[model samples]
Target chain A: MEQDLSAPGILTSQLDQAIGWARKYSIFQYPFVTACCGMEFMSVACSHYDIDRFGAGFPRFSPRQADVLMVVGTISHKIAPVLRRIYDQMAAPKWVVAFGVCTCTGGFYDNYATVQGIDTILPVDLYIPGCPPRPETVLEGLMLLQKKIQAQGRRA
Target chain B: MDLAPILSDIEALCGAPLSARGAGSDTVLTVPPAKARAAVEFLKAKHGFNVLVDLTCVDYQGFGKGTQNVSPAPEGRRFKLVYRLMALDAGTGLIKARLALDSWVDGESVPATIKDLFPAADWLEREVWDMFGVRFADRPDVKRILMYPEFTGHPLRKDYPIKKRQPLIGPADASARERLSPADLRPRIVE
Candidate 1:
């Protein structure tokens, strides 16, 4: 009684793969830039390095609209609550990238003021290790995140 | 600029002789806690020390021991409050005045605030109060500036445990009935 939508030479794939592919390609990032690493983040997102090629150039300031949280610098104990609040506010199906060595492990700030690592406050997906990672390193980190998204999709 | 005249003026105004150290433009005046405010006021009003560059507190604990071999502080006088004042007059390129309040302590013997004379001393005094537990009398707003309100014990104190971690979970209410003390909140020392 009804015509088949998938006829003849139609290619089929799992819903998870389709969703994963879509999600990976269009990652709207929310940059929680605090310190010096912000300069590197700017360079990576700007025209020369062009993070847009990977479809992650648009930096959404609001957490609600963002799919990825790129923590770009040192997270002090004083600022930890603020970081946690922003992470909690972001919609589900979100990922976090610790952009700098400071964000990854508090760098050399082994003091009362600095939080040892951001992972203690928020779950981190990937860590791009550098004082401030080069633009290429950031791009690689983005690619890794894409792969992670794809793998997570398969598992889901 | 000659600081002898200014030093004399400060000594006359405060009615106490200040122990001066260093020579030339880098003179440091060690004023008693009781007369620090008056001396600072005189310097600000007359000597053109308009900018309150910095106000910081130092704990003389464990002095004359370990790596730093220096003379220990006088009995019951554990702290020293240092005030750095700068005069940015057009004629004189930049004049720095260092005032040290020796025989100072946290609560009762702490120096008075110079916020009335130099408005910039407000935040610096608040910071000193926050870090060293030093009370600035006549300062209306003495709340903690660097550390959170719920934070117990000043971190900068010499006795504060270095590895002690205080991880706060949620937003702290100012008027919360139950508050955790330093002993209760400190991390358990594992063997």
Candidate 2:
């Protein structure tokens, strides 16, 4: 068996190429919106934000059918449990983009009802912070998560 | 106390002590617990506090520890009950009556039930009682709202502990690990 010194770099380059292809492909995502940020997510999906440019055309409704999990609002104590279960149910090679300050860190709801951040419950790849972030910010985070997924040879 | 004579005329009812404060567009009433239902009857049948806008609580024990619960206070007799009502009549205005009660005390006399007049009061009263530990003598279901049923203490009280932990932050050492883990990770399994 010959040990090739450049094989890892080639694999990495191939992985990068695969990620570029994935970024150009449509991504099915489950949006978990609980608060004001959900409105911005709507705006991104609308003509104003125009998410179609990134190849993420329509957001999927069912978790079983989606490749990305987008947490778009506040996760409360009552709701966090459900969110965790949903994250677990998503297929492997899945990516999560925490899409608002409330979802990323509980925002202004400094109380028991709201979870401080989604990371405590689910492993988040990207954290998008804003009381209700601009749709552009959400799209940017989505793009970053796609890049991260490419590095892992996964489709987001 | 006796709104009986005033009931005959709806306009005259507003002139009573209930609406005397008359803050903003909403008329106000301060009623004792015993006559709460009667006041509602008069308002619905005569004057217009008819809509039953909202029934909520105000904890007077100040801000305290535990969960981020504000509406409920642990103080036995220092809680306040607020009832918001509106005139269903398109032309009529809005009204609010705020009643102060100390129903948190186990034996301290709780004001009579408002549920009889507004069956809707049942859910609202239950919510207040569940959150604030206020006793609404006649409210049918006084269980937990906005908190787990097994929740230890009333969070809205001014003395509950406040702890802020950064999300997804793991413990730094073995002590932290032991604190977080259900079993002693240090214990070895000898096969």
Candidate 3:
């Protein structure tokens, strides 16, 4: 069994490709929604914008089942520890997407209450830059994430 | 029914104000420390000023230029408390008799609390206490309303730098090992 594990050939490579392709399609997301961008996320998740085309429409509220962490709004310093804790609780091979300008760069709240950017605490995968990114932009970001997942997947 | 009679009644309780302004039917009065609560109690009982809209504090250390109707304060008297009260009028919903009670207190002195009169003053005073670090003389609880208990300085004070942050944990804390990453929790080190 150990010799077979050590040997990397066509069969294992084909299995890796199959796994990556499967992972790229079906994504269970955990939305860490805090402020206004949550409204846009709801619009994108609901029937109007329809996020189901990307196969990531179903949201897992619990962090354990989710592979993607979509942080949806302003993350204040008061809530930063909680955000960090939630990120830590999610299983490995998890990706974090900063949803708005506030989560991306703290927007206009350059004060005591707001965290300047989320990257200071947790490592971020992609940043969707807007006060609230439009639904079309969100779909684009989702596609970008799928590409990222595909690239990162073959390693497993 | 009129503001004059109400002002006279308030003045009878708390002597004359430091500065008084009459903007329409409302009265904006800046009273002395101890007498303001008496006047508020009287207004609630006698007049129809039942609603305590807000109880807030302002740190005037580097107070900027103001509007035409500005109340002047003495030197070293930095913190000013503003209490807004409203009367529920039948004709105009809830703003028939709006009274703004403004008072100055040094950072060291504790002002007499009107929380006994208005239940809303409990949270409002606590919010002021949390933001400006001003304490009321006879308040019930000493909990911080907006900021956490571990938070040191008041964030809303004029002297407080806008960008200065006192975080509860992580990034800035010395013992930041409490915060864990995905790499930290892995069963084995990845080659």
The prediction achieving the highest TM-score against the true structure is 3
CAPRI quality of model 1: incorrect
Question: What is the per-residue lDDT of model 3 for residues B1-191, given as tens digits with 9 covering 90 to 100?
Answer: 46777777777777664467977546688878788788788888888888888889888775556656444666778888988888888676756778898888888878888877998898888888899888898764678987777788888888887657776554553222332233432111111
Worst 10 residues of 3 chain A by lDDT: A1-10
What is candidate 3's DockQ?
Answer: 0.18
lDDT per residue as tens, model 3, A63-133: 98888888999987778889998899998878888887777666777777777668777878877777788
Assess each model's interface with DockQ, reporting 2 decimals per model: 0.13, 0.07, 0.18
B68-187 in candidate 2: lDDT tens per residue? Answer: 766443445456567776555455342333222122332244556677777787777767666666666654456776666655555654455544322222221212221212241121
- Give the C-alpha lDDT of model 3: 0.78
In CAPRI terms, model 3 is classed as incorrect
Regions of candidate 2 where Cα sits further than 4 Å from its true position? A1-16, A154-156, B1-20, B23-26, B46-48, B62-76, B90-110, B162-191
Question: What is the C-alpha lDDT profile of model 1 across B126-167, one tens digit per residue?
Answer: 887787788788865689998888788778888877765565
Task: Go through the candidates in order and give each one's C-alpha lDDT.
Answer: 0.76, 0.61, 0.78
Model 1 TM-score (B-chain only) = 0.77
What's the lDDT of the predicted structure labeled candidate 2? 0.61
Tens digits of lDDT, candidate 2, A1-156? 598867668776776677657654667779887777888888998888788787776788888888778888887776766888888788876778778777665666766456766666667777777767777677777676656665555333
